[model samples]
Target: MSNKTFFSLHGGVNVIGGTKLHLTSGTDELIFDFGATYEPGKGRFDQVLTVRPGRETEDSRAAGVIPNLSYLYSPTPSKHVAVFVSHFHLDHVGMLSYLDPSVPVYLSQPSFNLLRQLEVVGEGIGTHRDLRVFPYGEWIDFGRLKVLPLPVEHDIPGATGFYVKTPEGTLAYTGDFRGHGLHPEVTTAFFARLGELGTNILVSEGTRACEAPRPDAYSESEIGTVIESAVRPGKSAFFMIYNRNIDRIATFARAARSLGRELVLTPATHHLFRTLSPEEYRLARPAVFVTQEFRVKGLPPWIAGLDVPRLTVPDIAREPARFLTELPYANLNELVDLRPDGGSCFIHSDGPPLGEFDPAFRNLKQWLRDFDLALVFARSSGHASPEYLKECVNLANPDILYPVHTANMAAMPTPAHGILAVSQLYQKYYIPGRRG
Candidate 1:
């Protein structure tokens, strides 16, 4: 067998999310992340035009939702293949169910636990397979390649970066990390360790590379402060947040408690909190929102089993000053029943329909406008700032830099002494060995 190691980009090049990176040493193959892109209306399929039920894989491939890698999904596959997930984001793990069950999939213990909970709640895609969970800093051998999973700080818990030692060289893949989130120290330590290991190649994410710095960009702590200040003293407040963003949830919970108001959560968020962190759920003491749908169709078994305080729209509407509730975009119709006061605050905290690009975002704005509610943005991004991204790249100081998961590769900073290779989709590049 040839001693050469090859690298290829199957997805997540020039786009913000759908990242699928493939590396190979002879017959041994490793796929870092097998997720789809997050662009809402740009894709071939939408909410109304859905993919076929049984032909999900086939439909996705035809629609360019996923890469056409037969070896990874076909029945009679070739080569030795394995998948290592960096986090539980849909853009990173959306296509995992489509992969052949014979291949082994690895994830961090926390990610595995959270994924199982998501599956149980019917929010997860694909069926369970050969999922192997590993602790932080443990090395897993894959014949000619060995991988070390390192913890990093992203918006969601259990986020990780990978340090792979291939036959040709060593490379570090930074999987969607930020230095301003709840755990900046973890990100700092991750880069410090990469510098110590002396990587030959660095595959980094530059999600914010092209965007100019904004004055509204606040740290996670700052977001909490902003939330506290934005809500009025004698008015009910509704905030939208990503369900998986436990830190943000904690921030809201803290803010609510400080104001002597009860933090109310959607049933889905309550399920996630109770399942993932029971202690947190207890400390937060949040009340679950009993939606109209839940009342009409009845609560599911998972929700019925939860022993927590519940609140209805009537309860919130009666004493608006006493509660702060979570409002998902899908539950916008509830606003009609709510009939919130004219000056009520609606804080958007990094939830779905994130930007104007998404159709749902416009709909969210329309709903708030119809209710005459004040829309306040209290969001901190999950990706690192451009300056921080450059600092991270310089710290690692790899021999070669491959910038991925960004809209503009030109905007990303290159290592002072390294070559910046603009990678193309499906293009193969030979990996070089470390210098003596």
Candidate 2:
């Protein structure tokens, strides 16, 4: 048997999200980030037409929703195989349920907490018995291959990058990150550590590479400022944000406080906040939005036991100006009861129905029109800007570059003194040993 290490791209390539990278050294194999893609309305399955029960893995594979690697999804256990998850984003951890539970799946502590919280809300990726938590900067060894989970700053908490040490050389994988988030120092330190380690190969995410400039790309602080400015006195303001973006949630909380309006969150968002950041939850003291559905079906034990104030549709409709609430697109029907005032507005803060491409975006627009709510955007991307990406590449100073999680591979920055090699899906590229 040869001692050469090999690498292959099984999922995220020429696309944004659904990153799966396979690395092998002899009999030991490592799979990083088993996730699904973010292309809405392009695939065979949709909201109405769902995957067949008991055949999810098979159906998804046949429809090209997931990689066609049977070994990873095999029912039988393989001791030599181990999986590493970078964060809890659905695009990065969506397919873990299909993976064999016997395989040891490793993640950060915050990622684990968030995943369990999501499970409580019926949005989890199924259960796995062998979930393990990896501490930041600690090395986990598997034969000749060792991986170090380095914390990074992304929109979601517990986002991480991996530094893999193979017999051949060292490779750095940036799962997903940004410099304009709440913590830029974390991102800076990550690249600084990569440089100190003298990494040989860089596998980076290029979500914004070659994409046209977004006018709404504000920094986290800037987003808060925009939110504050958008919410006028004597008018209700609804913010639609991704539940996992705790930083944005804090921003909304602060903005509401500054505007002297009560902050109201959906039950799911409230649960996530209390579970993930208890200290912040206590400080914010936000109210929970109690929908008619929750009243009819009875609140979950978590919501029922909460001591925080609750806001009903009638409560908000009576005094719209006193509250700044979360309005998820799924709960758009609640607008019929709330009957927002004349000057009220809806603030889209990096939530679902994200863009014109998604089918639900049309529905969101229709709802806003029907409710006569002014739509405004106050959002920031979770990924780094193109310039920041180039800066990251320069800082890492890798000998070779492999760009993933992007639609345009050609747009990725090449190392000043190294090779820019794009790995084809399922095609293995051997990593030469140091002595070879």
Candidate 3:
């Protein structure tokens, strides 16, 4: 029971999505982030096409998209593995739907609420019912290990990092964080607590820790300024952004309001906004254009109660400059009705294309060209830069460092700490020491 072992089930090297890490303290096995990968062509799964039915897990297992953790799928009860999720991102929890029903899945209260709402609205991707709301700042104890979920700032709400008091030593895992997000204090507090706890091994995400520098980057507050400066009063503005990014939406709403323009949102986007931030929703209500399509029969009570203005595509075409609307790539057909003039600006606040391999990006570029709208991009990455990562490593000062969630390990910046271990998938790293 004294020998502690660690290995990654996925996301070991040159992998982006499917991030699953396994740590064992003499049969007290714990699995963190049993998520799915986003390599569409290789894994043969994407936003449009899904795995073969009735064999989701089996086919994924065969394709190496998900690990064949036999213990999880055993028909008879053998060993119970505790599964913990850090956030609500699909890439981080996409595979949860296919997991064994017997295994317990833990998630933050906010994440649970968001998922529940999505499930109710029919946008949920088969959420597991065996979910427990994982509380922050409190440690949940197993026989030999204790896990503490700590809140961290990211693009989405309920993003968390885990602090595991293992048999070997304290291990800190930063589950996708950024200092430049809406709440810098959240990240600062996390590091402060990590410094106090004294982590021996630190597992961090290097999503943006690439050799190439992020262009036109701005802090959360500065994003509003950049957007405001980019557009004029007589021009229409359309933003292509993730609806889950509540902070970015709020910034856009505030900036649009300052410019005396209506911040028009698709019904789905408006639902997410009203559900996540009621106060911001109320504030942005006056300047928001709720689409006619949003006036459905089964409108949620909260959404129905809000006195939001319902606007049609023709309404926007009449006075395009009076609105800054949301138009995701999937809904590019709406642009035909809006008929935006050459003065319209398309602000691409989303991160760089998931690599040039993504076809959706090419389609989006073609659409923009066809519409003849000028393009502008202003965004802050959700992950810390390599230079800032070095600063975080210095601040935490862990004994061992393992960087995950990056494409190229060679281009990633190293931690200031002397010990850097490049661990392989399923290759056990023996950790020495035992928790009291």
Sorted on TM-score, best first, the list reads 1, 2, 3
**TM-score computed on alpha carbons, candidate 2:** 0.95
Q: Which stretches of candidate 3 lie over 4 Å from their true place?
A: 1-4, 45-50, 74-77, 125-127, 286-307, 351-355, 432-436
- Candidate 2: segments with Cα more than 4 A from true spot: 432-436
lDDT of 1 by residue, 1-436 (tens): 7667877888889888889889888889899998878887677888899999988888888876777777778766787999999999888998888888877888998898888788777877566467889889989999899999999999888999999998777988999999998779899889889888988888888999877879889999799789999899888799999988877888888898888899999887878887787777778889889989988887778888767788888888899999999989888899888889899999999999899978888889999999989999999999999889888888888888888889899898978878787868887777763321
lDDT, candidate 2, at 406: 91
Task: Give the alpha carbon lDDT tens digit for every residue of 1-436 in model 3.
Answer: 4445554546535676567878777777788887766764676766677778877778777766676777676545376477888877777887776676767888899887777766655567463547888779998997678999999888888898998887667777787888887787888788778878888877777777675665686777789988888786688888877767877888888988898888887666787887788899789883334444443454555456667776767788899888888777766777877788885798888743433578767878888899988878867778777776776777777777777777765555555654666646766655532222
Expressed as tens digits, the lDDT of each residue in 42-63 for candidate 2 is 6578889989999998898888
- For candidate 3, report its TM-score: 0.90
TM-score of each: 0.96, 0.95, 0.90
